[model samples]
Target: MTASREIRLAARPVGEPAPQHFELVETTVPEPEEGQIVVRNTWMSVDPYMRERMDDVESYLPPFQLGAPMDGSAVGEVVASRSAGVPVGATVVHFLGWREYAVMDAAAATVVDTALAPAEAYLGALGTTGLTAYAALTEVAPVRQGDVVLVSAAAGAVGSIAGQLARKLGATRVIGSAGGPLKARKLVEEFGYDAAIDYRAGSLAAQLAEAAPDGVDVYVDHVGGDHLVAAIDALRHGGRIALVGAISTYNATSPVPGPSNLFSLAAKDANLRGMLINSYFHLFPEWIGKAAGWLADGSLHTELTVAEGIAQAPAAFLDMMRGGNVGKMLVRL
Candidate 1:
């Protein structure tokens, strides 16, 4: 039997998850069935949404069961395959992450070309991360020509890609919000953002006002709580806002309050809509076609904060939750 190590939820977290909440275990890898494949995982993703799954609550995604292996996006090479379509030596993307190996049905694993980009890219830019930015800007809050765009969590995986996409979609001015001064400066120097807001430095509303003096025409919100309220306060007439995530409230022990300035959106004829990326699966092909080209030509810039080995997966996740990563956070197994 092939031995593998995987991370399991040791306990359901009440507020913030720590190393004690996760336990790494060594176990035998299951053999592939008739239509299943065994993949030796190379790279795994650590995302903010996974933290929500740790809580045993009703949400878009089911809660992670206690004492079982946790799963998310992972890319690996097929070492054993019982399916004809997925042969041995093929690399595929699957959702059986947090482990050194994964055994799943061939249908669940997607075959991607590594020649276009590296395997880890499938976990970030060329995968759901890029799609989230694309769908939000197009389907949810559609950026318009000459519009002023503001993106919160601007140094994160999704928010990092969002700034450039807004400009490409015809937004003349782009503003980004990140936690630190270094990341805030990178938003302009690296990601092509016109203005950067250091959300950690001071008041968000005041900084947002200074960034977009004419008022924001579109807002791609990744950090909810205060960021949502600030965006609403800075909204222009007919402004559009896409609620992608609420990292701010994920670990809240008490019930978080709603935006105080929601009525202002109605007064300004603005639109505020929430988006879940699974609903936008149809845009994958379109996004890959454009994003792949942009990445090759240096238009779409991406960075990675990788933690080596399965043992560090839990620590990597904890750091990412606290905004330690500048871009996509991944674990190399």
Candidate 2:
């Protein structure tokens, strides 16, 4: 057995999670048995979806059980293996994060090539973060030539990539909405957005109108409250919305109402579709190849905000929830 440090849910968070809600525990991790492998994690991902899981309420994913390690995406090097499929020293990706080490069935881990990009890339652009953007744009709300697209949380891990993908996919104009000026500027200058609206500055609807005078054909929603309503109001005929997240309401203690102008969907013949990345894993191979090419050809640029050490995972998660990170928020161990 080996000693491992892990973060467990001590209590269900009330609003935004606090340090008291998490407990850091050090325990012995048993050796991998038959068909099992042990990984020493190098990088782990903390995303907005995890915030929902912190609550005990039912959602797409089950709530994190109290006194158990919370899991997400983690990439690491296998130090010991009893399975023939995965050998020692192989880099692997699995859903066993919030810890320094993970021991699980070999089938639970997917061996990844570090040479392709890096172990961290698998948790970011080439992994779940990238796949989320790709599937949402291509399948949920595809961009067409001459179409105007708007992405909320534009400077975030998924939104950053989503904006760039829309542009590459033939959107004539792309607009983004972020919280601050720096992130807004980064969206326009770095992420290829034609306009970046500071949702903190004024009315989102007015800003979106000014950004796209002709109205938008595609709306990639990450912040759902007022942003969804704004997109609905600004959508032209046959506009499509990819509802990926509702970060604004993720920590709500009360029921948050949907867009009041949802009637506009019928009025404008628009479509709104929710996206869950787990349901689209089949498209991962295709997306990985395309995203790899984009990365190699300088067409895709990735940014990361790394929080060092396993102990900092809670702080990193909180910072991400507060929109403190511009791109992907990762905990590097």
Candidate 3:
């Protein structure tokens, strides 16, 4: 019997997940059933959304069960196949956990071309992160030419892509807010953001004003709390706000307050809409086509912070949440 090493949820975390929250175990790899394929995982994605699942609270998605493997986006090579459509040796992406191997139905996996990009890219830039950014910019909040666009968490996987996509969509000014100076520089110099603000320096409101003096027409909010307040204050008349992930308040035990200036929405006639990327799956193919073209032509660049093994997944996740990572955080197994 083939054996696989997996990471299971050892405890429900109250705040940020610690090493104690996970336990490693060895288990026998089950044979592929009627329509299943066994894959040897190569990489796994670590995202902010996983923090929501660690708690028992009700959410858009179910909580992670204790003692069970934690699931996220992953890329793997099919080592054995019992399904007709899936072939052995194919590399596929799936909702597989932090395991060395997984056996899942063929239908649940999306076959990817390893020749196009690295296997790990399927779990990041070329995968969910890319799709999420594309959907937010194109479907959730469409920015027109001459519009001023602002993005929070500007150095992150999704936010970086969103900023580039906004520019590509013909936004006259693309501004970004990041935690540090390096990320701020990256946003402007590398990602084509017209201006970048270092939110950690001082007041976000002041930084926002300097970065987007004309007022932002579209705000892609990735961090909530103070950033949300700043975005509200910086919005132009009839602006649009796309609420993506609220990374700032994710670890807070109490409910984070909404912007005090939410009344600005009424005063400015602005629109604030929450976006859940899964809701726009029907438009994914179109978004992918656009992003793929940009990626091929060097119009879009991807930044990844990769951990070397599955055992480092928890540490990598905690680092990402703490802003230790520059871009997408992933684990290579």
Candidate 4:
């Protein structure tokens, strides 16, 4: 038997997740069955959406089962394969993560061309994270030429790309909101944002108004609550807002309140739309075609905050939740 290590949910967290909520256990990966492949995971992703999944709620994704291995996006090289379609040396991206090895049906894994980008990139910039940014601006909100755009959590995986992509999509001005002064500075200096607002500095509504005095034509909301309310108030007439994520309210033990100024959307004839990347998976090819070229030409830039080994995955996830990461938070196994 091939010895492997996997992380299981030891307990559900009532509030913010702690290390006790996870358990690293040694296990075994069995031989692949017909139409299956065994992969040694090289990289895995830790995202904000995962916090919601840890709860026992009926959300977009199923809650993590106690005593069961937690799973998410991962990139790995196939070590053994019973399916001819996926060769033994193929590099694939799949949903089984939080472990050193994964055994799953070949159909569940998509063969990724490492020549176009690194395998680990598929978990961040070239994978769902990047796709979320592209789909948010192009389909969900569709940034118009000369439009003023605002992205919350601008230093994050999706926001970092979204800001740069907004400029490429013809936005005349781009504003970003981050938790700290350092991240706020990076938003303007590195991520191509014309202005940056440090939410930690207080008075979010005032800061947003100062950044986009004319009004925000399009907004990508990653942090819900106050950020959503602020965006609603500063929205231009007939503006568009894409509800991509709500990292702010993910760990609440009680029901979180809605944005107080949500009625402004109706007054301004604005559109507030919620988006899920899974719904736009069909556009992956179109995004990669453009994004890959942008990366090669240095038009698009991405950063990674990496944690080494499977044992560090839980701590990495907790740190990511607390905004300890600059970009995509990854665990290198």
The sequence of per-residue lDDT tens digits that candidate 2 reaches over residues 152-182 is 9999999999999998899989999999999
Question: Candidate 3: TM-score?
Answer: 0.97
Whole-model lDDT per candidate:
0.94, 0.93, 0.87, 0.94
Residue-level lDDT tens digits of model 3 in 44-135 = 98899999999998998898899999898899999999998999999999998689999999999999877777788777677878888877
Clashes of 2: 0
- Tens-place lDDT per residue, model 4, 1-333, is 999999999999999999999999999999999999999999999989888888898988999999999999999999999999999999999999999999999999999999998898898879999999999999999999999999999999999999999999999999999999999989988899999999999899899888888899999999999899989989999999999999999889899989878887898999999998889999999999999898888888889999999999999999999999998999999
Candidate 1 Cα deviation (angstroms), residue 32: 0.9
Clashing pairs in 4: none
RMSD (CA, angstroms), candidate 4: 0.8
Clashing pairs in 3: none
1-333: candidate 1 lDDT, tens digit per residue: 999999999999899988899999999998888999999999999999999999989999999999999999999999999999999999999999999999999999999999999999999999999999999999999999999999999989999999999999999999999999899999999988999999889998899889898899999988898999999989999999999999999999999999878898889999999999999989999999999999999999999999999999999999999999988999999
Candidate 1 lDDT: 0.94
RMSD of each: 0.7, 0.8, 1.1, 0.8
List the lowest-lDDT window of 10 residues for candidate 4. 294-303
